[model samples]
Target: MERGEKIVKRIDTAKEAKQNPSYFEALVELLFQLADDDFIISFRGSEWLGLAPHIEEDVALSSITQNTMGHASLYYHLLEDLDIGNADKLAHERQAVERRNASYFERKNGEGSYLQEPYYDWALTVVRQFLFETMKKVKLETIINSSYQPLADIANKVLMEQPYHLAHWRMWLKQLLGSTEEAQNKVQFQLEAAWPACADIIGLGPKAFELEKHHLIAGEDYLRKQWLKELEQSLSLPSSLFVDNHPARGRYGEHTADLDQALSTLSEVYNSDQKAVW
Candidate 1:
């Protein structure tokens, strides 16, 4: 039998059929968004695996990358039970248009390719991840109280393991932002560059209305407002520094060239033999 056929047969099993259907749809969409975002970004993170500026920091950072990928796998497996697709195929083979992830997560690490002249901006990475994880933590907190039992259960599980991701990024952000002239300059530079795209990650895209209305997740404004509050309090930065308008919303499927490049790189292996079992 063809690999796709085998995957289909496996997905058609009892566990797939046993879910509460209504909750299943909502939960699946949430899972896809969560999983795809983490998967793509973590892949980007892995590209920096050996290229990090410091060896000790490299080891510590890889742990977060692996954890995020692991979380993505959990969501993908959950999706498999819902008959979406095989976990590996969904993660590795999908086109950018088919991917439900945010553009922020898909953006490049820096100016050069990971394989060459990897002048990666560690400060940008630190700032973007710290900001992103802060929002994710806030949202996950709310998700833990969701009306959908499955989501709430998963959210609880994710939260249990999330502090490490948060702490790691937060430490990087604080240290860089609070450090010497060069470090602070680099961090500030990246933070400003990231300011415009930061909104896209939190927008929740086309399904925002439905997700919130159905209680699958919280509203954008609420999450944004709360996230800003927490960030301001934590960083003690001037509140006036943040910009209100995020020009492009990734939640709406709007993306940049970086996303396209990233999609091509990540999907290259899976798309090669989508029909094969391996």
Candidate 2:
């Protein structure tokens, strides 16, 4: 054993987290990012619910939306255990600038409202979800081995339902890409749009060094490599994929106005008289 070396202890429960303030804060921070990302993307999914091209796909995709929101709730509850706040309040009450989700998850679905004058594109939906699920697979794989025991357990539970989501989107993308030239081009265009945005998805936020230093999670470099390996094997990358181009990195509290609109819609019911029983 080397002199002056410190041993990192595993956090087996919420009480252990509080005993180590740094560990608690890091766990809470990472959980906030995970919860917020899932919440926003699932909200986008709900927006596309009735507007899908095919009835069967619409129904199937709706299930995924429900599952995503469920995952968000799981993460939010972990934060609740940390004394951050109740899960519902954490999910619905936070201002946009306080969110820690990647900006990639908050982008608008398309040109108009889901209920009227709709111009939704299935290609973007498929690309976005597939890409996110792939990245999520990598993230969860690392988090399953996290020092925080509760989070590791949550990752195991999440992985059970998450693979179906990845597979569904993967199937959509391959079929669309293998179809007509028009379909291929449409899908390809959306792929390019998301390519540069992968930076935000791969990042561990401003506290990357600290998170890795504490053995809370793998370093951003390791996570990115894992994600890129999966991505390259599945979908051929555009040149832009390598660029660290993020319009806004939400992990650092930067968010677009799109997030403002989304928060308004998703929390409308909950925010209406915060005490009413539904």
Candidate 3:
């Protein structure tokens, strides 16, 4: 699996992947990215369980959030098979510095708790979900031909349900942008705030070169171009909205206070009884 060499063989199991150190390392890193991204964003989605803009939206988002969390679990299970750690501990016990999710996904919904005066922002939710699902769709499609057969299988399974998820968010974004001036302004503001923080989301982390060299996934440039092309054609969003200038690089393990808060909240129940069989 050297640079520029075609991946002639498919790794059918984690044991086969572990035979090659380079391939195994890159595969683990890529898995963490996939798992962490979905895990954190799904938690954010759950924060809106009963607080969505309307009753219909509340139900829709809850369903979508559950699906996303299940997707995360699938990826984490793959890691567990690789002997990295238990999927539960990997998801719940890892610290912010150990997380590989993009910092943007970990940002608070708004300036309040979900149980108390939950002043969540629907516009921000719309923008973030649209962007994230679009990226997820592109990434999963690209990895459908992954050198790791197990990962490719999971990608195919995920794609079966992911399109509906993307459509759900796209509909929200379109309706928001098409509504009155106030709605349009809120969406625009969120886009501006999100643009600068999304660079890490599209990245494959510090082992990116290895991931590409091993044919575990496509190059970052290809993924970014495809993502941008999809957003531009579908949403008519400006290319400038895709700029990469964020200071925190979650792919490199750099995160924010938002992630610290999110980790605490998400892990509370698991931490309560580490040996509990859920």
Best by lDDT: 3
Ranking by lDDT: 3, 2, 1
lDDT by residue (35-87, candidate 2, tens digit) is: 98899989989988778878998898899999999999999999988889988
True-structure lDDT of candidate 2: 0.86
What's the CA error at residue 158 for candidate 2, in Å?
A: 0.6
For each candidate, the alpha-carbon lDDT, in order, equals 0.73, 0.86, 0.89
Task: Quote each prediction's TM-score.
Answer: 0.82, 0.93, 0.95
Q: Residue 66 of model 3: what lDDT?
A: 93
Error of 3 at 252 (Å): 0.5
What's the CA error at residue 238 for candidate 2, in Å? 2.9
Ten contiguous residues minimizing lDDT sum, candidate 2: 238-247
The C-alpha local distance difference test score for the whole of candidate 3 amounts to: 0.89
Model 1 lDDT per residue over 19-124, tens place: 6465455566677888877887788788888888789878977988888888888788878866788898888776666677777677788788877787777776
User: Which of the two, 1 or 3, has more lDDT?
Assistant: 3
